[model samples]
Target: MNILFVLLPLGLVLLAIAVIAFFWAVGNGQYDDLDSPAWRILLDDESKPPKDPKDSP
Candidate 1:
């Protein structure tokens, strides 16, 4: 009974924060190019070989 009052407001506050964060992300282009990053992980950077410190000048 008493716990409900505390839990309900706490849950609502968390929900409000989540919604605000989602909208903020959308406005900041956070969701743009969602697929490219996933594909990028599978793609290899073959243009250059891994540099060795001993070989570096």
Candidate 2:
């Protein structure tokens, strides 16, 4: 029974911290481009040429 007092407050504090972090992330535009990152991984990066094995010093 005594543990409930400590556990309850700890749980509430953790929940509050999680909510604050979520709001901070959203305010910082963290979720604005969710799709682009996923699609970007599937695309090939052609800007840089592949390094040649013989070019190593």
Candidate 2 lDDT score at position 31: 93
Report the CA-based lDDT of candidate 2 relative to the real structure. Answer: 0.92
Residues forming the 10-long window of minimal summed lDDT in candidate 2? 48-57
What TM-score goes with each of the models? 0.75, 0.80
Please give the clash total of every predicted structure, in order: 0, 0
Model 2: per-residue Cα lDDT over 1-57, one tens digit each? 999999999999999999999999999999998899899999998875549967655
- Please state every model's RMSD to the true fold in angstroms: 3.8, 3.2
Error of 2 at 27 (Å): 0.5
**Cα shift from native, residue 14, model 2 (Å):** 0.4
Pairs that collide in candidate 1 are none
- Residue 24 in model 2: shift from native, Å? 0.6
lDDT of 1 at 22: 100
